[model samples]
Target: MTMREIAFSLVAVAGLLATATAKAQAPEPFGRPGASDAKGAIELIDPKVLRVCADPNNLPFSNRAGEGFENKLAQFLAGKLGKDLAYVYYPGATGFIRNTLNAHLCDVVMGMPQGDDVVQPTNPYYRTSYAIVTRAGADLDGLKTLADPRLAQKGRHIGLVANTPPGNVLARLGLLAAVKPYPLVVDTRVDAPGADMIHDLEAGAIDVAILWGPIAGYHVKRSNGRLVETLLTQEPGARMSFRIGMGVRHSDQEWKRELNRLIAQNQREIDRMLADYGVPLIDEAGAPIAVEP
Candidate 1:
């Protein structure tokens, strides 16, 4: 079957997992879902500081050392607002939002998906898609999509984060039976699946690896041109791309609006930051963000 088949069956598998994970990971309702009462439900915190909640060891995204792109982005936002940047460290897994944002440990989450129910999202500053990583100038040089028949060829092995969209796609294509599935629930202190997948690809343990665009892009850059990445822009009637935005508590409408304004006003700067970190952004039309030669 082709990726079209993967596309069709993917919804079922994904929906099942999303539902299960959400239910299992769901924290207490965040003071209502969408709109929040600023005076009652929301706690008034110091608006002069950019208190960002983030995972301390999730790289290409965040870390305690202020080396990740999200940390840099936070610093930029804080600078724009003329506020000091502060962090509330938490593992980005189940109850992350509940324990951090909801509990008022911090004011914002710098890199969450748009439309996330746990918190209100600002207008997305950038959008990204899944990426395919392979050795540069290799036989898979021109491979663009998971639908490529070459992926099913003899002796081919694929690496993917288990229970993700790409993993669901591979499973539907009957490729998962041969693919090496990396655990999604990793120990934040030790493993970084995205970096690990790229490392495995470089070491010849896997033929190709499918990963989120930003993660793949960042590692490929750090790989010193040893690896190449192409954004997967086609899904044949499935969602493969997502818009990323910062999240605030649902009751923080004023805070969300202020952030939306900041995002719009500073989008160019934000895009530059993302590009510098090797995030593969795409236009709303699903075209790749052009890179200057």
Candidate 2:
């Protein structure tokens, strides 16, 4: 069988395994500090210091020193609520939500992607699109989006992060035959596919790359505009525009309501924060979009 067939089979098996696991597990509490218990009465958390969970070193998104976008957003929320701010730093990979927020180590998670399996979201604060990055002066300039027909031509290679929306979309479209899949998180070695993609883009080895908006934008700015970024069109079953919101315990309805209010009240400031982090704001139609307070 082909690689795609193998991948499909693995996915089917994984789904069955996940369903079996869920069936074997017992039902548990879903909400956070101020949420209702089994009896359905609301429990409230005393609003004091807003405990935010975030990554310690991920740039353009979050970090420990209040330098990233989420950190700034948390500070903004604290200022609005007249509360102190504290953070619990951890790596933002697979178990971030469950280990941090669900475990009650932190009261909130800044910049959690909407629709994530764990934690509950407040009002969505911003929307971002995935992008295709290429070398400066590459022929990709005429390609406005991922659906551009020119990509099907031979002799062109695109790099994608494995298991992400972009990768899955490409695979479904039969573009994976000409694309190189990379692991952005797992293979941290210097010669890994992700690092190689970056190096090759600078070296003009590949014609294009698919990466998340914030990551691509950050690299473009860091590269002094040596790379060109084009926002991709939304594909069916692809998470093109992701809504980022603050995550609270599922039981924290009071806090969630308060956060939603804060998000609505400060939409403009939040937009500015995301822009500061180089996240491209785009609308459902794939046009340039901005957030306003």
Candidate 3:
């Protein structure tokens, strides 16, 4: 599939915190009925329905047709809670939380980076990092980190999403000059940065591409064994990794705890779903989350 079709898919599962930029740093909590108060009295969300705020078109996460991994997981969780599943559809971009969660249209966002100030996070369900994509047996195959000297010494071309943490890491490693910047704000009509990067790597247009792990993993799964993905978690101070969790309104402490309980109760199932969708999950220590046999 074209990257345009799956552009938001990888980052959504990778927990890139891209949505964190679309809204204010500190999201306002839910308010009671008939009021515009920031600290309005709590309105209890109904437990009979697991209302989710999600993108209608984003793949590998959630879609209007409920085909994505997050969609499936939401269904499972809702079933476990003895609740029906519902969605508040919106584009997964700026103003997402403002229009959906904050507007009380939905009670949960299934994939938010932990520690995100925009939403109160549940206990992290998965961890992942940026990854380097290269030819499976190429000279760069053994490449583990952006600090590898051969990258600059051999004048290899690198592709990365602009203004992302990986881009900052490359710049700090003095490899910015050889890097090709892909627009973070892409026009789906004409640009597919992540997919394009993979295509270029296959065609030898770029020697390597640094991408979010979920994105890399998804594309690599379709690469016919031609691509190699190396997670960049070994680099000290790279800050290229993050843990992802469910998002709830700040005042929904009870709701958050309930979600956390669900997470703990079904972590193995959750991990299996992530693995099925090719999310490159890692642990707090940066080790891969192994899949079941």
Q: lDDT, candidate 3, residue 94?
A: 62
Per-residue lDDT tens digits of candidate 1, residues 1-293?
Answer: 33322222211111101111121233344453333444322433555667888777777777899988889999998899888889998765556666777777788878766655556678988888778999997899988888899999988989877656676667667787669877665446576677778789999999898877777888888888889998887765346787778877766776788889899998888888989988888999999787552
**Per-model root-mean-square deviation over C-alphas:** 5.7, 7.0, 5.5
What is each predicted model's overall lDDT from 0 to 1? 0.70, 0.61, 0.72
RMSD (Cα, Å) of candidate 1? Answer: 5.7
Please report how far candidate 1 places residue 204 from its true position, in Å: 0.4
Compute each candidate's TM-score over C-alphas.
0.85, 0.78, 0.85
TM-score of 2: 0.78
How far residue 251's Cα lies from its native spot in candidate 1, in Å, is: 0.4
User: Could you give me the TM-score of model 1 versus the true structure?
Assistant: 0.85
Per-residue lDDT, model 1, residue 262, is 91
In candidate 2, clashing pairs total 9
lDDT of 2 by residue, 59-111 (tens): 55555567767778788888998878887776544455556666666777676
